[model samples]
Target: MYVALFESSHGAVLQPLDESGLATGEARDVGASGLAAAVAELEAGHPRWVWDDTSRWYPRLLAEGVRIERCVDLRLSHAILRNSALTASSTLARSAASSWDRAAPETVELTADAALFDFDGPAQLNSAEDTLAEFALQRAAIAGAADPARLGLLLAAESAGALVAAEILYAGLPWREDVHDAILARHLGPRPAPGVRPAKLQAVLERLREALDAPTLNPDSPPELLKALARAGLIVRSTRSWELKKLTHPSIEPLLEYKKLARLLSANGWHWLDTNVRHGRFHPEYVPGGVVTGRWASKGGGGALQLPKQIRSAVVADPGWKLVVADASQLEPRILAALSGDRGMAEAGAAGDLYAGIVASGAVATRDQAKVAMLGAMYGATTGESGRLMPALTRAYPRAIGLVETAARAGEKGEIVSTRLGRSSPPPGPVWRTSQSEAYGEGATDADVSRARGQARSWGRFTRNFVVQGSAAEWALCWMATLRGTLDELGDGAWLTDSPHLVFFMHDEVVVHCPADAAASVEAAVRESAAQAGRLLFGAAPVTFPLTVAVVDDYGQAK
Candidate 1:
């Protein structure tokens, strides 16, 4: 019987069954216990169904020849899957909390005609744990503080700040918990000494409110309220009695405590701070082609490869170690140049910064203005300030503008676009078609349709961008492949993948977590990869993409 489990859009386990294993073949009146009973008998025990035929449809999809190979064992899958569960559905989390005071046993057993392999093996478990640990450590190093206490606090603050930011930035959008967790985990490395406590921070805020004569407040006010008060200059007094700044005060204590808790959570299956082998060396994970537009990802460390300039304080190298960072400036624009075969855009990139060139070419008033202009032209952003400013940019960068505009039109018409390397976009289905028609329908007074059209336009813009971005991703993949091969030739002693391991990815950048000795070679590998990416994408284009290089002891400086 083809027992299957499928995940709903909401990620709930859905098990759809006919009397037998087939989804559309035959129907038999049978209870859930029939298959359960049979499987139980076959396994000779009550096999804990982690997920079964009634739970998910993706597994059963294999029967229809939807090819998918397992990347890790069941145990590793369980871990990743469990991680997903922690934030799966907010409602579900609450429900799970109420349903089980203790952890529930989750198990799965399956007998397939193809192959039966043990997923929860020792090597896989160890490897996964190590990966997680390394990721955690790399983040800690990037955050600045060397000691565990400070690191914990930094992590907590960053997480809290990000949670607040996400709520503010995308108020109505559905949030993915994994995205939240990853964002929270990104910059949690280290902090300066004498971290504040979360509770104390609260008390300080209360006192500040009392001082301001605004004591009559809702008890359920968000922590961001206090932050706002602080920003507004109403909460002026520092909680610290000494010369230490506001960050080191008793009021910030709760934030610190939260950090300590986060540290504990992060330190799962690993050693504690003082005695841990990570002594002063700050190594960050590098993920190439992580972003939708061929950027990079940092595994655990904050985006050390692309950290903001002022925050480079965290990554202090060991005695012999140095950070060597390289970034492709105006990458997206350059990719646009190649994709569109735009001489103007290519010349702009060749001259230097695309934005600067736009300004110099009299395309826009300033570099910042050029951004809004170009973005507006490509995506058909004909509203707000962008609409007012984009015409000149389009006139100046005609080829590039034409490329994205064409793509946008194609997307609006429900057409597919492809990356250079066969990564064709799937056509918009009935929903998209209906939405577009609704958006462009005659005699339509409602702006919802227009708004939807704009969205469709943006998707076209995205698809257009994706062709360049996805192709760039292919290039990055090739670079990584080449780098890995090259490192293999250098032997384990001279070079290693463990340090500059590929961990995280986003669009337009790369981060490499590396040992001291491997830094230079890794730098070379990075450059070579960029060159390789160029070769892979353009074959023989006149414009060569150059990565502006920087070497820093800390990740914060790289940005």
Candidate 2:
């Protein structure tokens, strides 16, 4: 059953629908303040809720201590179907932008203090009728898809990801402020006041100034520092660590140290802790499907996706709880193994270390070489040592390499390539098409041809990686959804933080915060869900997606 939620005069209208989103029963009306109780009661039926935006509606229930099992986020689902190659012929895909395709809210926080659902005139689909109509359209699109099962699974996984993102946001990661402060102080002396640098950073700056012989040099100023480096006869293009490392000047060490420390101070320093971490939790707002490849992205605050290793130790578990961190091992490579039906590649990953298995299989002389060659194949590398090792990799894993090579060729020809689940690459832009056209036109300049070729190769590389990365993302989502459902079942009727819930999710890594007693069960669920996700994506496929599971007291010890 699908229960659609919409804005009513002073509350919400819940219309229960069948699998295809057609009304099957009488609707229920609930007020703004009582919405949480209404949803909690409805949980008995286990109906998948349908809402315009999960970010807009679910937070209130979470805030009220209510949790729903499943949901269909219209906005996210619309984005997928609209661009999906499988649903190209459907009305929803062909139609222009509508309210169902609205962007993510500026602030994802929608408390119970306001109306149950935010309304924006008739332009947005906030009314009950409009919401139901949109749901019907989405169902029609999925039903008419070339591969309905695959597209439906994609939508389900995507929506589940939305729910997971919101839940994780509410159940913020446990943070240790004192530990963070200690880490900062150890690396960067005492925390500096206001705009001043820390003592250690100041010392490094002094060394840099002394080495460059620029008495007033500001290491923070890239242009000024580059000028000083040039004056010291070290001509470099930029202040990037890699470029600076090429020149072994006495200033190089201090300059790199300054850059590292300054980055830490700026990105995740004391101010960041004060702003993002609240009440001993780092509440990050995650935007699911934020990246074009369907990967998640953190909003302005939190810096959740880019949590620096310098402060990872601060991600501590509560006293009675433990952090269960598990990252799928070599996820993309394993995804490629399944997507291509390459038995050799699948066999290489069967041992849990794909690169090592490849070396053992005589694909490459060393594990490092196998890794570099496999990466080169997936990323369309045609030069350097990685490129040189590609022939051996291709010979060993023909189907796997061939799959990416075909995707790269399609991309070079300005055609679309899709992942196993149906999320297709966007078409070449008008400018790119024009460049390709001009390069082949009469009297085309050599420079134009060269530029067009370079652009084609660049796009080819992106498509080559996209199929694997995007499919890997789908696999990760399925894993999370499966893990979430199993954990929910194991919760024995508890909600949110009271149960084993996901606290953090990176691209391929997921961290669950659970009671010490449930840690072992959660670890088992994590491994079980990984196996299930592979089967869901590639039924009976031999690819083994192994995970490195860690039950640790802090995130720093997870790896």
Candidate 3:
């Protein structure tokens, strides 16, 4: 009989055993007989089951069945089994599939959730539907919804927006939701009253026909498009519900269209997502190191984590589900506190808000100005309005500015910058050096060269922020690993299987898609993770970090 040793599936090593069921440490000593004779001797001693790659076992067994070994010592291997009968193997494989499905965590399962069934709604559809619907509605309401095609677009937009908002509220991290909401509050005071519930998507012709003379109107484009535009800071709403205007530069409209295309792509994405959801629950995969700049990336679908208000309405909860949302208050500024070890900054964060500190510091007249100034400083945006307003900020928070500026300068020199925790960015490529020299090269004395040099200088400022942003990403990664471990201990039985899993992550934000029943646990898990993340990133440091959380029934509310 032919014999071969097979490796265990779990990667364990097996050794020979004696008749007494004890390890015979001397297999190498009797090796003159080679592996075959040694195996026979081991069978005489006691049948020893050795773990090795299964490739070894399959070949020898294919020729003939191996002689029986009497070794009592053995280990269990969980390899996929093949039966004599084809029908039997198929049944075994089916059973294995069911077992894996049942044991898979909610986060992992979301990858498969998007496909199974169609829960078509504002939250579930693409940006085109919501934007088109809202545009049609607004045109009808304001411009009289006279144009059927435009009106159709508006209503479609609204429907899509509402559905997307529902999904976001259901999946996003608390701090991420807070940042989104803050951006919304900056422009739209509060969410518009829930306008219309989403139903099955209408045929294109019928939608166009209905929009022709629709009575109701809303100015906002479809939710998905609006979200893409808002993130790029292109659109803002006026006081009236039906009044909306574009804020971003017209030159960037192509970029806007690209975003729209992305939104459109999300339609197919939504379909794929639903199909992937195991059973009835969709779980979008959350990639921890997804963003190049330390933000979260969605594996199965890109739920809009970067977008602004109104669009959030597109993300909706499923049937029999309510969104439980929470967001952190002033997360970045608070992170700065822990990073710099500045007592004043920490105190400012501890006192509820950071803009208030800027006001108290006499940095700016209102919180809005403070926001523009601080953001401008970090981004190194100095030429436009934000740049003009930056002096006062640099004067007040010299250290903050100093930190970014110093890093920016080092980056211009093509050097790596490190955060407090020792995480460093990758080295600048050769392109950076060539670009820097070309801009400031003595050979080029024209005005264009000077401008180029200035632009390069500006890029240096951006590099400074990249260091901070990138390091912040590392902190997020550490937090994710820690939280995953903690939640695993909660045991599978204690948690709902179809609940929200980690669907998306952005720098300093995380999105969890869970069922309504698990929202409480989700919130607790986030808060605990944030706390734990702080400890891990800043040990023994006197810093206080607080996350602003809001539980919303809709993504719009969370926004």
Candidate 4:
């Protein structure tokens, strides 16, 4: 059964629909104050709640301690089906663009004072009738897809991810401001006032100026620093760390230190602490399906995706609880093995560390060589050590390497490639199409053809990684979804919002804050979820997705 929900003039309106998506009953108008109670009553029937946007409707319910088991996020589902190659022939895909194709509304932080659902807002697609219509279109599109089951699974996983995003935001990551301040003070010295450098940064700047003999060198000024470096006889083309490291100069060390500290101060210093962290929680706004490869992207909260190792200690669990930090080991390579059905590659990944297994198989001379070769194979590397090692890797894991090679070739030809579960890559943009046409048409210049080839290879590198990355993201969604269900079952009879639940999720790593007693259960659930995700995506495939799980009070102690 499906229950379609929409915000109307009265509040939230819910209408029940049969399995075939036909209306089964009249719509019920529930006021803002009664929404939670009405949803709680509907939960007894296990109906999949269909809503226009999960982030808008779900967070308030979660705040009220109402957790729905399943939902159909129509907005997310619409984006997938409209662009999916498998559903291209469906009416939904063929229909002219409407407001449905518009970008999602900007995500906003939900406060306690905010209304449950806006009833008197400007008219949009939140009417009960409009939601029912969109739901029917999505269902029809999925039903008419080439591989409906796979597309359906993708939709289910994506929707589950939406729920998890909302939940993770509500139950913000456990953060310790004191620890963060300590880390900052230790590394950069006491936090300096606005527009002034910290003690350690000032000290480094003094040393840098003396070393370069510039007296008034400003490390923050890139062009000025470049001139200073040249004057000191370190002729470098760029000030990039990798390039700078190649030069030996008294100023080099302090310069690098200055850059590192400056980044820390600018990206996640005291100001960041004041703005992002609230009430011992870091509420990062996670955008589900944000990346083209399906990875989650964070919009705010101080570089949530790029948390520096220098401050990870601040991600401490609450008192009397533990943080279960688990990351899938060699996720992408293992995903490649499964997707390509490469038995050799699968066997190599089965041992937990795919790179070590590759070395053991004599695919490459050393672990580093194996790593470079595999990355080259996936990323279209065609020069230097990676390129030199590619032939050996290709010979050893033909299917796995060949799969990426095929994707690269397709990309070079401006063809679209789909991931394992049917998320197709978007076609080349107008610029790329124009370049290729210019290169191939009459009277084309040699430079035009050369430029076009370079662009093609650049895009090829992207597409080559897209399939593996996108599929790995799907696996992650499944992993989190399975773990969420497991945690809910384990927390039965307890208020889940205050019980053991997921608090943080990076690309492959997840941190669960739970009572110390539940650490073992959570660890077990993490491992089980990895295996389940593998089975769900690639049934009977020999590849294994192993997780390195650590139970610790501080997230930094996990590894």
Candidate 5:
């Protein structure tokens, strides 16, 4: 069952849709004030709600204490169908860019995804008729797709991700402002006033000045720092940390320390606390499908995804609750094994350490070499130790290695490569095509050939990893979506905050904020969902995804 919802001038409109996406009943009118109640009433039947964008609708519903079990985010689905190779022959993909293609809604600041008020964009398409038309096109595209099952799964997983992102936003991650402040103070001394460096940072800055013997040098300015270093017999191109680290100077250690502390101050300092955290929780704005490879990204200077490990100690559970942290072990490598049907690699991975498995197979002398070789294969590493061990790794796992090699060759020829579930890579842009074309022109120079060849190889590297990374992302979606449903069955499971709920999600890691008593159940659910996700993506491919799970009072202990 499905309910296609649209923004109505009077308030909102809901149309019942069957499995085929055809309307099964008349449109039901809902006032803006009564929207949440109306949604709750219909949610009782557990229909998969269809809407223009989950970002625009789900956040508001979640804010009003109304939670939904399933949804089809038309905006996200449109993106998939319009770009997927499986649906290339459909009218939806063949048509010119329409309003649906450019419909990211006007977002609120702190209430980022909570788009309660109506604001019109140039290409807004929220009418019931417009929504229905767009949805019908999506259905047609999926039905006409060469591999409808995989495409449909991709769409469903993408939409579910939208829901998960909104829910996490609404629920907010447990954060202790006081704990964050303590961590900062311990690293950088007391919090300084605006534009004033903390005591510890000031000490490092002074040391940098002394080491260069330039009393007036401002280390904060890159040009001044470079000139100072040059004048001190440390000639370097830039003040970048990596270049500076290679040099043996009294300034190097202090400079690196300064940079690290400065980053910590700027990214997660008192200002971050003032803006991000509220009432003991931090609400991070998540943009689903933010990465082209289908990974989630945070918005609005919160730096949620990039939360430095130094401040992880601040992520504390509530008094009577625990944070259940679970991360998949060797996710991408296992994904590669499953995708290629490499029985040997699969067997190696069963030991819970694929690299160890490679070493055990006599492919390499140690786990480190196996890791480097495997990373080289997946990431197109063609030099150094990785290159040296390539033949050995290849002999041990030919199918897995061959798969990435094939992807790399296809990419060099500017051909598109799809993930295991059919999320195709976008074609090269005009500049890339032009570069390759010019390299083959009659008057082409060696420089042109070299540049074009390098670019092709670089793009090949991207594609080689794209298949593995993108498919791994899909597996993550399935794991999270299934875990979400399982967690929904815990406790009352109706009011999101009352039950065990997901509070954070990294690429392959998830943190569930659960009551003390339900921690064990949530842990089991996390592992069970991982297994289920493996089966869903591979369908008995003999690859197992194991997770390292821990129930801790704070986030840092889980690691």
Candidate 6:
């Protein structure tokens, strides 16, 4: 059963729908403050809530102490169905663009005491009638899809992801500001006054200037620093750390050190601490389906995705809790194995480290060679050691290597490729199309042909990775969704906000904050979720998705 909730002019309205998504009753108004109670009552029937945006509606509901088992997030569902190649023949997929296609509304972080619903901000799904119509279209689109079951699973996983994102935000990650400050003080000296550089950074700057024999050099100015390096007879193209590392100079070490510290200060320094973290929690605004590959992105917080290893100590669990950190091991390569049905590669994945398995298969003598060769296969690498090792890898794992090669060749011909579940790569831009046309058309120069080939290979790299990355993202969504349900069931008598729950998710990693007593159960759940996700996608294929699960008191200790 589905219960659609929509914001109305007077208040909130709920309309019941049968399993087939047909309306069974007229809309009934539930006044603004009455939403929680209304939803609480509806919860007895275990109906899936259909709403415009999960980020907008679910957060407020969670704040009101209301948690629903399932939801059909219309905004997220529309995005997936509209762009999915599997749904191309559906009316909703071909429908003219509307406000629904717009990116989900920016999430507003609300304090617990703030108003539950802010109607005056902007009208979104303000009419039960419009919300119902959108839901119907989405259902019809799924029904008419080429592989409706697969697309339906994708949509369900995607919508569940939105709910998880909102809940993660509300729950917030456990953070220890004291630990963060101490880590900063140890590396950067004491926090300086506002607008002033830290003592350690200033000291490193001095050392850099002295070693380069340019007393007045401003390390922050790229052009000035580049000029100083040239003046010091270090003729490098750029000051990127990789290039700097190749050169042996007294200043190189300090310059690299200075850059590293600067990044930490600028990205997660004192100002970041004061602004983002509060009440022992770091509430990063998670944007679900933000990345084109379907990975989640974050906004309005310290580099959530790019948190530095040095500061990871700050991610301490609450006193009575444990952080259940688990990351899928070699996720993408394993995904490629399952996607291509490469029995050899799948067997490799089923064993421990896929690269080690490749070595054992005699594809390469060294693990590193196997690593680069597999990476080259997935990423379109065709140079030096990677290229040299590729043939062996291909000979050993023909199905896996051939799958990506076919994708690369298709991309080189300017054809779009779709992911396993049917997210198609966008066509090349007009400039690229024109360049290819000019290269092969009436008259062409060698330079024109060369440039076009280069462009094609570049695009090929993108498309080759897109399929594996996107499908891995789908697997991750299923993993998280399955784990979420498992955790909910484990903590049946307790509210999600007050019980063991997910607090953070990176691409292949997830951190669950749970009571110490439930730590073992959570670890089991994480491992079980990975197995379930693999089965959900590949259907008993030999490929195995293994997770490195760590139950620790601090996030840094997990690894």
TM-scores, each model vs. reference:
0.50, 0.94, 0.51, 0.94, 0.94, 0.94
Tens digits of per-residue lDDT for model 5 on 517-545?
99999999999999999998999899999
Query: In candidate 1, which residue ranges exceed 4 Å CA deviation?
Result: 1-312, 316-319, 378-380, 437-455, 489-506, 513-521
Query: Of the pair 5 and 6, which is ahead by lDDT?
Result: 5
After superposition, candidate 3 runs with Cα above 4 Å error: 1-281, 298-324, 438-442, 492-504, 511-522, 552-557
User: Per-model C-alpha lDDT, please?
Assistant: 0.44, 0.86, 0.44, 0.85, 0.86, 0.84
Off by over 4 Å in 5: 102-125, 235-240
In model 6, which range of ten residues has the least summed lDDT?
A: 108-117
Residue 484 Cα positional deviation in candidate 4, in Å, after optimal superposition: 0.3
Give the distance in Å from residue 101's predicted Cα in candidate 6 to where it truly belongs. Answer: 1.5
Q: After TM-score superposition, what is the CA distance of residue 502 in candidate 3 from its true location, in Å?
A: 4.1
Preferred candidate (lDDT higher): 2 or 6: 2
lDDT of 1 by residue, 293-346 (tens): 333333443332443332234334434545555667767667777877888777
The candidate with the higher TM-score, 1 or 2, is 2
Error of 1 at 497 (Å): 5.6
lDDT of 3 by residue, 331-358 (tens): 6666666766666666655676788877
> What tens-digit string does per-residue lDDT give for candidate 2 at 1-559?
7888988887888888998888998988887987889888888898899999888898988898888889998888887888889999999989887776645222212111111112221225467877788889999999899999999999999999999999999999999999999999999999878989899999999998999999899888889988999899999888899888888778888899999999999999889988988899998788887766677867766677778888999999999989999999999899999999999999988977999999999978998898888888887778998988988888998999999999998878878778889988666667777888999999999999998998787778777887898899899999999999998977888877888989898889999999999999999999999999999999999989999999999999986
- In candidate 6, clashing pairs total 0
Whole-model alpha-carbon lDDT for candidate 3: 0.44
Worst 10 residues of 1 by lDDT: 108-117
